[model samples]
Target: MAVRNADISVRRGEVIAITGQSGSGKSSLLYCLAGVLPVARGEVRFDGRVLGALDDEELSALRRERFGFVFQYGELLPELTVEENTALPLRLAGQRKGEALATAGAVLSRLGLGELRQRRPSQVSGGQSQRVAVARALVHQPAVVFADEPTGSLDSANATAVLEEFLTLARSQGTAVVLVTHDADVAGRADTHYRMRDGMLAPFTRDAS
Candidate 1:
């Protein structure tokens, strides 16, 4: 199925929510924007940089340096401690072990996971593990964060906690957040919202009688 063209701009320190039913092209839009999927048409830009013009290597570098991603699943390494998992991106960027771990420590602290840094993913609760995923994504201090169903597996309270943390981090660090979710409560928390239907996205509107 062909995905529809979307022209969207997200500024610093704002949270933008993308909501749609399953198979509505929400995830496809994200993948296209992130350069994970090739765009047959249309263009994506970030902070004035044209994404479509970049080669794969260039896109990878840009993504590494300028973007963070949180998948629905934690995607943590089984053998790594929370701290190690959180430090992966920094390490990938060529920071020394000490520096990467330090950065991870700070991010974990910010996410309220400092006390559990030494534990493995299997040793923590689902919510705590997901928090570690959030820390990992933010450790590199990217300009934009893309999250796909970030709270999809959590309980109500846990989902709320994670959503609030995402908003707080974006606000405090001046990072732009683009989140994909089916949850209305999660969508409602965003600064701006868009809903996808039949492969097109439109601004969310509420009826006031």
Candidate 2:
């Protein structure tokens, strides 16, 4: 099994972090919790609703409406402008273009990307592109955000800046954040920290050696 008996919970506006070595099943646990992967046993619940009980359409709708994701690579569509990419989630959730764009613009501004809204992802620096990705994940104000290696590609300075902005915005809006990374410094910033080893998940502390 990639992940075994992993169990955890997060509250509104709280930040949770999982740190583990490569192939230790950290991503597997994150995907299961996000409903992106099926649980072979046990279950995942969101807002009192069992994720396994929902049909695919229902699950898709739920995710689109209430969840967000950030990846190590930013994953912004190169063909789309920064603002358009940020607005994509709201658009997919049925918001009007005008309103979605306006909302996206606002988020981009808050993330210090207002002036670059019209630029494409390829036109920005790695740090700027990552910030745009953060803006996209947050534009919809989802109840939860799942981030995997969100800052693994950047230098320490850029990583710190992006993470600070990401958490500040999420916390301000009462959104829960689940982050997976191998960086101990990053994990230490979370309200709760867990370490995965050989497919098992367990609580972590600074004193743990």
Candidate 3:
């Protein structure tokens, strides 16, 4: 799935949705923009720097220091406690264990998981685990969060809760969001929505709901 001529420009603190069927290249475009995948031809610029031109170490630093991510599954470590799992990014970025855990605890509290900090990922419900994932993603307050099918595994109510929390945090922190989903409701919640087809993206039109 190769994306060509993609000209997406996400504004600060904006919520942008990209919707498509499975294997429609939506995630590929995201990976390219995020610097996870190499841009074969065109340039991917972030904060006015060309991602393709950056060296490996610089790219790694950029991702570590400026970006956040959420996936379809919570992807929390099974052995680590919820707090530890949420703080893993900070820990990897050289934060002390005590301070990382403290920050993680505060973010968890904001996500309504203050009481479940000691539990492992397997010990929590799916919805709770996903909320924890959200906490982990935003704990570092990255410039942008790239969420791919973030609420796909949850039921409607839980999905709503997760999306609401994401929006609230993004609004308060002025972080941007790039959400990829096939669900209309999920896409509808974003300020701007586009449908991906054959490696191309076009504006999404709302139908009577």
Candidate 4:
């Protein structure tokens, strides 16, 4: 079993961090909670509804409308400009292109990418690309964001920059965040911390300053 007997609850607007070594089930737990993976024997709830009870279309709607995601690498479509990439979620949700692009532009500006909005992923630095990924994730004003090793591909400085901006925006907007990483420094920024080992999760006490 990848994860067993773990009970995790996240309050609205809270930031939670999960840390563990590779193959320790941290990411598995995240996937289960995010409804990206089916649970074999447990319940995953969101907004008071059991995720497993939801049909595939319901689950898909939930993900598209309420949740955002960021991965280790910035997963941007190479052909799209930063603005276009950031506006994708809104577009998928049936927003008019002009309106979606406008919202995307505002978010990119908020992330200090106002000048780079027209650039494609290939034209930007890794950090900038990651920041754009973040912009895309937040453009829809998702209630929660799931980040899996979000800073893994960046250098120290870029990682720090991207994370700072990400948390700042999430906090300002009261968006909950679930961040999975193996880095202590990254986890330190969360309001709550947990460590996964041997397919189990337990609270780990540490100053979150």
TM-score of 4: 0.97
Per-residue lDDT over 83-104 for candidate 3, one digit per residue giving the tens place of the 0 to 100 score: 9999988998999999999999
Give the poorly placed runs of model 2, Cα more than 4 Å off.
207-209
**lDDT by residue (tens digit), candidate 4, 74-165:** 89999999999999999999999999999999999999999998998999999999999999988898999999999999998999999999
Listed in order, each prediction's TM-score against the native is 0.95, 0.98, 0.96, 0.97
Winner by lDDT? 2
For 1-209, candidate 1 gives per-residue lDDT tens digits of 34786778888888999998899899998888787888887778776777888888899998898889999988999999999999999988889999899989988998888999899999999998888988888888789889999999999999999888877877788888999999999999999999888788889877410
**TM accuracy, model 2:** 0.98
Worst 10 residues of 4 by lDDT: 200-209
Tens digits of per-residue lDDT for model 2, 112-156? 999999999989999999999998998899999999999999999
Better of 2 and 3 by lDDT: 2
Top candidate by TM-score: 2
Error of 1 at 89 (Å): 0.9
Model 1 residue 51 distance off true place after TM-score fit, in angstroms: 1.6
Worst 10 residues of 1 by lDDT: 200-209
Off by over 4 Å in 4: 206-209
